[model samples]
Target: MATSRGGSNLHWRNSNPATDSIRGGSAQRGIRGGRGSRGGRGGRGGGNASTPKRDPPPEPDIVAHPLGELLQTIRISDLSLEAIKTSKPTDITDLKYVASYNWMEGDAPTIMIPGKPPAWTPLKQPLRLKEDAGTYFRDPNGAQYPRYPAEPAVQAILNSNPTFPTSEIDIFACGSTMGNLLRFVRASSKAFRFSVEVVGKTVFFVRKENSPKEVIENIHGFGHSFPEAYTTWEEDTKGSSSHQRIVQYNFGGLVCVMRFECDGYLRDGTNQVDQKLSSSATSDENDNIIVQALKNTSVSHVFSTTDESLSIKTGGNEVHQQSIFDLKTRSGKYKRDIDMSDFLPVLWLKQIPNFIIAYHDGAGLFRDIRVQDIRNDLRVWGQEHKDDIQQLAVLLNKITKIATEDTRGLLEVYCAGHDLEVRRQHGDGVHSLPHSLRAEWEGMSDEAEESDDSLGATNGHGRSNFSYGDEDENDSSDEDKDFTACSADTCGYCGTCSY
Candidate 1:
């Protein structure tokens, strides 16, 4: 007989379900084992049937590269001046990695390249660098940089100097007004020499340095004095057209003026000067005579005034007067009336020679004269007015200083933006000519030299080159001879020309 098994242990076969069920039933009926025995076997089988677990595979080791780790450890603060100065190995090549670190130093650190000295170094005792207060900087090659990095220095110097007084009169009140005022003052002081001539009603101002003969030849009438004469019935009916005629004279060989008239309409439509029949004909004849006079006299100055006058009425009658006269009357009856109408036309004249004092009444004397002139006049009146001139000069100096400072600052900013190297030259001051003019002169000299060189190369053996030094020497000798020939006590030349 075979051993008996419980129904729980029976296994079904895939091929005949009916046959398996019948076999399972028979096996169950034949089994003699109790529930407790089955239970005990099931527990023992469960304990031994469990699958064993294995440990997880070891994780891959994580190792960082030395260079990468070093880079990661670097910080901007580590690139300080002290760190740079005391860097290990001293060799720049070896410490290139250290230099790679971001730097957070004030201004850009002077990078130390191989074989190059740094601009700045860490002081043994840390200290702030002070800025230079000079207008110029000396470079290694002795070159000059103007209004560059040293603008602050230039400004400091200007500030330290005496300031101009601007309160009494604004030198820059009008375009080119300051320059004009300076010119007038210099002329008045005899610093600039000129000649003035009066011919009839016209006055002429000519520079002493210029050839008077040339000016006389060039003088000619221009623009119509009264354009309305062409169309106005009054002028046509009177058979006279108002016009200006410029004449040249032989005496002194300068320009001459014929007749200067100060006549216009009054508010009530009356002429300033009465036009009597005899006076009118005489005036016409005089105009023609002036044209003829140019043949005999050399006029050096011309005067005319275009400024309008305010109408004045006294005792129910309109009084026609000149603006200059009106101003004088208003100032005081004691004040002399200045006839500046003749002086006002000078401003319009072209080709002004050097040292000439031309007056233009278009720009009235009261409006154009410098404060210094007024002060001078006051002094002439009395000695108590000396302080006024000094005060005015102070104001002018202050304004000039401020302008110079602003100009310097602007130049510095421009140079910095362009990353240009700045250099300084010695002895730059107001007494010297402007830098732009000096530069132009230098450029012209260089061009002249170049042209001479090219000519020399082309000529080779054809011609002898003139010596500039010899020419300059000859000119100086001539000037000396002229000076010795003239007697200081009794000069044949005019006072202006004698100088």
Candidate 2:
């Protein structure tokens, strides 16, 4: 949480190669690499025999959310490129910024207006960095849902002066859900599963596994510590721990809204929108709703109760989508490259135009750092991966169609390695929003259709879209296939699977 290390000494490392390599090895041992163990490494930066963590700590205990229940399961084969060629390929279009909020460190779930990310303030010279410690939530609010991962986002939307249209939107998801589907399209070899439920016309994809809060363990890098050492939260939005942003776009024919975590932003909130567009090789489709986020507070929750936990504090500068960036830290010892093949899709999903990567010696001294604006690069990658993207569009359309067929409205999506399945959610599964908020969100159906129409989101011959934990007697009867998400043993990477 300290401000980025500062100095005017931006120079490549000039240290003994053999000595630095040994020190980097010790540094790696001091870090845990995934979301579950995000900031929980507690040993010195030494890979010594005495380090207790040489044996990783156990994964978190996650079970018995009253909501995850299987109503039905429809199995289908892996989507093929050949099959995609036969069907009309869907293209993502009409991207736009919808709403955003920051999490407050408090007892109940709270919101900060026009929430902003940490500012990018790199230190002038490389310095020995401290390691991260303690626990972190994959999603602080989501970890506490029935779960309504999208509830706070929608509430933040409605509370704005001019809310984005919601009626015609076909799907509401997070980066993990969509990314899982995209992986299926590309035919990935990993195992993954999530829940899908329908509230109104929008299908919500929730990634509620066994444990929402996880203990840090089994890590070997500086992904957490690097950011703590390098980035600083700006003044206006102080006291915030995490920021979530929502973006809407038409992929294939479906009008989609997705929420993602933002790392931080460039301090100079200049005309990044214009700058991004000027540099992009594509058209306005990439320019859908990047800048229309919430501004003023005008809360009007008809179902407002004195106990409502959502409080939108008024403060924060409007951060242009283009000015924001995704960050990753790596060790320079292995000379490992930052794989764009993996990172690009994430940037594309969030419409992030900038990426920052810092590479440090094992001793925690960062010397090789790069900040890039890769909007055009993402466009090119999308085109190159057009087949996978098209399959994703088709898959989404199918899920949407089938989920709507069930009168129950509530549903779940489970992808058991190799094939995709759509099932019924536990009747007890929590609603995506509170009763009042749910009513308000569904009521937006009136204007969402107009927005969907204007944006040209197609609803057929194309796709659709999944969370939570709770143990049930029914879980005993359910078959555990290649992966069983309800147990810590199967919650790949212990909830921070190698994404």
lDDT: which candidate is best?
A: 2
- What TM-score against the true fold does each predicted structure earn? 0.16, 0.69
Please give the RMSD to the true structure for each candidate, in Å: 51.7, 14.1
Superposed by TM-score, candidate 2 places the C-alpha of residue 238 at a distance from the truth, in angstroms, of: 0.4
Q: What is the lDDT of residue 306 in candidate 1?
A: 16
In the range 1-499, model 2's lDDT, one tens digit per residue, is 1112244233222222211221111111112111111122122222211221233323222233332444444333445543445555455577878778876544455678677776555543345654433344344555533234567778767766346555667899888788877877777724555666665567778765445454334444455666554455556676666677888888767888888778777655231111122334333332222111101111111111123356678667677777677776666676665556767876777788877666677666777766666777788998898777777777888788777776545566666566666666654433455555655655565345444554444332112211122324212221433333345344432221221
Which 10 consecutive positions of candidate 2 have the poorest summed lDDT? 293-302
Model 2 off-target regions past 4 Å? Answer: 1-78, 81-90, 144-147, 161-163, 269-308, 446-499
Q: After superposition, how far is residue 20 of candidate 1 from its true place, in Å?
A: 99
lDDT (Cα) of model 2: 0.55
